[model samples]
Target: MPETTLRTTGIDHLVLYVGDIGRSKKFYLDVLGMSVAHESPRHLFLACGGQGFALFEPRDGASPETDRDLNHVAFSVDAGTYEEIKAHLEAHGLEVTGRRGDDRCIYFRDPDGHRLQLVVPD
Candidate 1:
């Protein structure tokens, strides 16, 4: 018998727990230009068209910088925006890395130390 698989269109949303919802919200809004789709006392949902993400207040003392788990979120951008994105991140005092200059993606971290990436569409 074959294993069953659940079909899905794509990622509808993503959630990230942050030490401070306001700080995280500001970072995403200011850096990525993500407008708030919804807001609550301890959560802010930023709309990214079909897909969006939420910044939620941390519980039980979760540490952002000390977390050893290696996870990152990548956002797709236009080819022309690749350089502009890199420049924007740098202008914001973010430490951006591409591993190699030829790489189609640049990696950086948010104020909460959450890894983020910007990749150009193929």
Candidate 2:
């Protein structure tokens, strides 16, 4: 076997298909504290911890669907701020789920139904 020479860097951004870009933008910016990098009628770009996420509204007026094969997107958070983050999300009426096997992470869904996670180092 020959050694591969191709190399790739980390994730540049994540694009999520949302039903309503405005609603999704509000949820991300207001709840998650993400900053707006760019936006349009059908798209919104959010910046989180230097990474970017694009919320795209489909033209067909269909709701966004999650792929059961892929679980969720996990964002890294400081261990000290974990409780505060949980509380903030809960305060916004978002249901936070704790994994049975992991105590250092919590899961929740965005307004568009995309699953997301906040995780701290063990």
Candidate 3:
């Protein structure tokens, strides 16, 4: 028999079940500036750097609160890009909070109450 093992390539996408897809779409696309890969009434897929993130409406009875585990997810960008992105987000009325070490980051919350962050890699 051939080797039976798990071959991992890389993360294809991260999905978030939000209370409102429209709101999540705006946050991920407009505020965070992720490029849209696909969009539907109930879902939005965005390209974040080389990775991807999908936001969709939660099923009935599903609690969006469970997304607390995903409280934040960040993309690594050039150290110089942080300020630019931060300025853009702020200009659009997004609030940013938190920074530490040589790495600078911006923090904000999505419409469904999920926290997100963007970090500039060292």
Candidate 4:
């Protein structure tokens, strides 16, 4: 550990590259009901829990299919809401593909194959 380090509060934003802007826009903005905070020619910033959830397409020759991050994004939810969200995804024909060891957290993938999770506080 460093004696002095950067004082970070929280994530200001997160950027994810997707295959198509229109398709990812529909999924995050329409399907998941994330409200748009801002937009550009390619970037769409979503208002999520006081932080920015950004989705955009690669415009500078980077391929989203081959040059994207290999990880998942997780969001914390209340117990009841967690259950409700899982059910909601199921209603949309999505399968719960995995779970945490505690079982209070569930995992699934988005339309673009990005893994996402919802967890309840212990």
Candidate 5:
């Protein structure tokens, strides 16, 4: 075995498997305020700040299963804007859960049952 150090940067993109690409795309774009970087019939690329995310439609009729206890995606937001964002999500009919032990985070789920969080850095 060879000993070598592997250096890597931050996440470039994260792909989420969705049953309906169009509905997922609209949720990300309209709710999260992400911009569309690219799109196709089966996939959508959305810009998140400097990084990006992709929505992929599975050919099979099954949707992706996310572990309720551990699987989730979190995005950062300004501390001042935290309350406004939470309120917006609620106004849009999404259930938002405040962190049990922390005051700086909220959890919610997307249309595809993917858990997502909005967090404010201290």
Candidate 6:
């Protein structure tokens, strides 16, 4: 008999524990322009295509804080969409942190202080 089991589903959501929920929400919702599925003063969940992402305040005494790193959550856009997204994000006054001229990746940071990168996949 075949083993009875449940196949794992894709990512339900990516939870980002931040120092400030409000600031993180603004960056994801306003800066990145992701639609909000659920939101509150303490937490905010946004739709990222089929998956989702949740931003909330960090728990007490989780870990000692340090400077943000280059490793960040990445989004893949159409290669054609790079210029358009870049222009739109810049117009909103968000600085593109790491820009690769040859390759197609635009990097930035969220308000609660997390790095993010958008790449136009070849």
Best by lDDT: 5
Residue-level error in angstroms, candidate 4, position 122 = 7.1
TM-score of each: 0.80, 0.82, 0.77, 0.78, 0.83, 0.73
Candidate 4 per-residue lDDT, tens place, 1-122, comes to: 66767788989998888877777887776556688899997888999778899988888857777335768898776445556776777987778865545767878877778888777665
Error of 6 at 38 (Å): 1.5
Tell me the whole-model lDDT of each prediction, alpha carbons only.
Answer: 0.79, 0.80, 0.75, 0.76, 0.83, 0.73
Model 6 worst lDDT window (10 residues): 61-70
Clashes of 4: 0
lDDT of model 3, residue 68: 62
* Candidate 6 per-residue C-alpha lDDT over 8-115 given as tens digits, one digit per residue, 9 for 90 to 100: 678788877777776666677776668999988767889987889887665673631426433578876644566777787888777886554767888876665567
TM-score of candidate 2 to 2 decimals: 0.82
Which tens-of-lDDT digit does each residue in 24-73 have in candidate 1? Answer: 88888898878999999888999975688888776666665427634898
Model 2 misplaced regions, further than 4 Å: 1-6, 67-69, 99-103
- Estimate, for each residue in 1-122, the C-alpha lDDT of model 3 and write its tens digit: 57778787999999878887776777777766788999888788898889988887767757676546565777666545666777876887777787645767778767776777777665
- RMSD list, candidates in order: 2.7, 2.6, 3.1, 2.9, 2.9, 3.8
Ranking by lDDT: 5, 2, 1, 4, 3, 6
Candidate achieving the largest TM-score? 5
lDDT of 3 at 122: 54
Considering only N, C-alpha and C atoms within 3 Å, which residue pairs clash in candidate 6?
none
Can you rank all candidates by TM-score, best first?
5, 2, 1, 4, 3, 6
The residue ranges of model 5 lying beyond 4 angstroms of the native Cα positions read 1-6, 67-70, 100-103
Pairwise lDDT winner, candidates 2 and 3: 2
Question: lDDT per residue, candidate 5, 60-84, as tens digits?
Answer: 7765655533488898875446677
lDDT of 2 by residue, 1-122 (tens): 66789766777788888888888888988987789999988988888887888888878786666654257888886544566777888999999988534567889998767889888565
**Which of candidates 1 and 4 reaches a greater lDDT?**
1
